[model samples]
Every structure is written in structure tokens, then in C-alpha cells.
Target: MADNHLGEFLRARRAALRPDEVGMVAYGVRRVAGLRREEVAVLAGVNADYYARLEQGRERRPSAQVLDALGRALRLDADAQAHLHRLAGTAPALPLGHTTDRVSPALRRLLDGHPGSPAYVVNRTLDVLAANALAETLHSPFEELDNLARMTFLDPAGRLFYTRWNWTAQAVVGHLREAAGHDPDSPRLGELVRTLSAHSADFTRLWNTHTVRGKTQEAKHFLHPDVGPLTLTYLALDVRDSPGQQLVVYQADPTGPDAEALTLLGALTRSAAL
Candidate 1:
């Protein structure tokens, strides 16, 4: 899967451009699709053998400088560049495929207390391990039992939540692929890859792109049944007790109706408990 991802990504990027677009003229009869190995190596300022190794997945880790050069040569956008860094093993990241730690009563209390914020915990497979009232209410589709990637790709309502569903969907799928890289031995991760590959072509395409993303600022768009579509920034917080287990939090703009809605949601949860 990793080899397929890297090869396909390079191939797609190469095909997306006409050689003339990158100032490489169609000099002669080219047999294969996209730039040849040597062409990309020349553009990226690396030896053909080295680039070949990288493309073949022989090279697991490459320097940032080398990756940057490749990014520039390929004219990769920001997300694509980050993906390249991840493939090169340059991102400061958590060990994936490790779903550890019980949600301690204390941790559960914290999520419960943050009633206004859409908060939840994710396992390595990006499964919704647990969620609070606001999270359930806001991400209504995810309230059902499904992994994040599955919901992102397989569910229409889940897919509908994102304003740029295509981009967000790609990222979610890529993140799952990255998890696979971090821990190749995981049976559950393997099963997920198999399921997604069989299920969603979009996921299969993005997965083959060999993209990687660290928890950067992600503003999610959700079409809540009651409050309508909302945009909220997301943060992934690591639980202290569990090294790789992360607590994801969602927050809206300070003065927006979403903020007000969150407050109301919290109150409703409180009233229900009372």
C-alpha cells in the first residue's frame, strides 16, 4: 500500500502537468505516462537512483531539505507538501495503531464539563471512542457507530457535513493512511485499509497519494439538524495518561450564533441531567 501510494502520488503530480507547463518540452516519443524517473530527479536536484528508491518506498526517511526541493520541483500545494514531509518521516508525530487507556472518570468528567464544546476521543483508527452532548448534537451523523474515515467516505450525511467535503474527505483518508505507516503491524488498521479500499474510490485515490498531515488547524463545517451548517476550528489534544490517545475539541467563533448555540446546548444537557 505504501509503495502504491508513493508511486501513484508521483505519477499523478507528473501527469497533472503538461511538460511545457514545467518548461520540459515533449522532446521525443515518450513511452510511459508523466515524467520519467530521471526527469523528476533532475527537477528535484537528486540522483535518479535516490529518487527511484524514494518512489519505490526503499527510502523511508528523507531530509527536510530534500523534501522541500521535491515539493518545489513538483509545485506541491501546502497540503501536498505536508504530505510529502510525512512520507519522508519528517513530521513530529505520535505512534499510530496504539489505542490505549481507559477514559478515566476524571477524563470523562472533563469532557462532560466542557458541555458547550464538541469534544471526543479518537482511537488510532479514528473511531469515535466517546463523545459529549455537544459533539453528539453537532456531529449528528457521527453519533452512529462508525469510524471517522468510514463516516467521512461512506455516509452521505457525513459527507454532506463538510463545505469542502472533497478536500476534507481526502485529508481524513490520508490521515488514516499515515496511521498505517506509523504502525504497519496493526490488524485493525489493516482491516480498515482493506474496508476503505473496497468501499470508497475517493478514499482509494487519496490513500494512494501518500499524503500525511499533522494536527494543524482544521476548521470543520457541519450541517447540524437544528442550528444548520456550522464552521468550527478543531484541536487534537493528547491525553496525559495515554500517550497517543487524543482528545479532540471543537470551538466556534466567539460572537457567532454557533457560540450561542453551544451555550444553549450545554444548558439543555444540564437540564436533561437535572
Candidate 2:
């Protein structure tokens, strides 16, 4: 519902950092959360009023240098820095409908080859465009599997499916925020955000944080109804031909219990499909 998302992001990031983390001494009882607006301005080597204006949406377009400085001051990682640039209107926008939900045949072949692992493809907006049998089995417990963001927040089973629900929720929201920055005018994305914001308070809270991050390599813990508890490492690979599509593969250590469970689950899935 809020339109000044860039400002909201800046404000949230500023509120997340503490004075001590930025090498500033805290002498008095702080009245505000995280670093004050003045503190961020000082750390980034910018005027306080100017930074204030940036957060207030009065200054929509910030120079690249300022954005870089702000990124540094906030201790943002590479993805977050890129996201900051996008929010500040310094990054190039994706052409409307740049991302397609259609999965390529080559990608499908790749997914088919990875029978031992759960492999799926998602677009910028976290839409599950394509999935292998293992991947489908992996997410079979969910009522809806089309959109990862929606399932992560809106579904009642999401909390149980993701062992670390809070972390996954935050990561999903951050990824969506990053996507929004690149494709600001996406109708589907706008609709998804509005829908999630209205349905889930937790989604709304995390969304308000404006954190941005790409889905990279991570260890994910899942409590699959069929597989029991499993821990798998996932890799997110960009589909070079499809600009905004990512091929994600999840695999458990070959000698581990999770791998055995996954094998059993695969067999079960095959039987069910037949």
C-alpha cells in the first residue's frame, strides 16, 4: 500500500544498524532504534538534512556516489548494495514483461538429469515456472506451489515445512523486494505484494523492512511430510538466456541420512505418480 518504498527501505536499514557497529560511541540512553538519521549522514559523509530528505522521498534520485557511501555506511553486502542502487533509481530498469514464466526445454532437460536432487526454476518474482519430480515432491506438502513468496507467508503449513521459518520468511521477502526494485511496474508483482500484505501480518512486517538479497547458496532445513526431517544445501544458478530466471537445485550429502530419506521419498513419488 505504501508507495515510497525506497524511502521505507532506507529508513528500515538505518534503523537496523547500531552506533557501536559503525565505530560510534554511545554515551547516553538512546531514544531511537538503531542509528539516528544524523549518525547515518555522518558515517556516509553526507549532510544530515540531505539524508533526511532522501528518506522522506523529497529527494528521489540520489547520486551514485551517495548511494555507494550509504551502502558502505550500512555495511550492506554486494546484493544489498545493488538493491540500494536500484531503490535510489540509479540502476537500470528491466523492460516490462522482461521475465517470462515459461521454462525452456534445455532447462527442463537439465532438471530431468538431476533426479538425485530437487531442481526447480523460478523467475524474478519467485514464481515456480518449472520443477522436476524431486522438486515437486519436495514441495508437495504445500497447498499452493506456484509462487514461493506466497506459499512461504500465506500458507498455514509454511511454518512447519521450513524448519527455520523466520529466516526463510525474511529471505523470501528480501528476494521479492530485490525483484520489485528491478521490475517496479510489474502488475503481477504488485498484486502479489498487496495480496500477501493483506493476508499475513508477518509478511507485512518483513516486507516493511525493505531488505534485499538474491537467493544464493544456502543450507535449508525442511520437515517434509513424506521424507521426515531433512537438511539440504541449495544452489541458485542464473539461466543466462533467461535474464530473470534462476535454476535452483537442492541436494543432501550423499552419505547422510537426509540423502537416504530423499531416495525413499523419490521412490514414493514415482509410485504415487504411476
99-157, model 2: which lDDT tens digit per residue? 67778898899999878789999988899999999888889889967999988988888
Query: Candidate 1 lDDT, tens digit per residue, 1-274?
Result: 4444555566666655567766887777788656777887889899999988877777757789988988888878776776666555686656543347467788789888877788898865787778887777666655474478888887777766776788788778766755654554567778888888898898887776555555667787767665666778889887876755678999989888878766766666666667
Distance from true location, Cα of 60 in model 2, Å: 2.5
> lDDT scores for all predictions?
0.73, 0.88
Task: Pick the lDDT winner.
Answer: 2
Task: Give the TM-scores of the predictions, in the order they appear.
Answer: 0.77, 0.92
| Model 2 ranges off by over 4 Å | 27-31
Residue 229 lDDT in candidate 1: 67
- Residue pairs whose backbone atoms clash in candidate 2: none
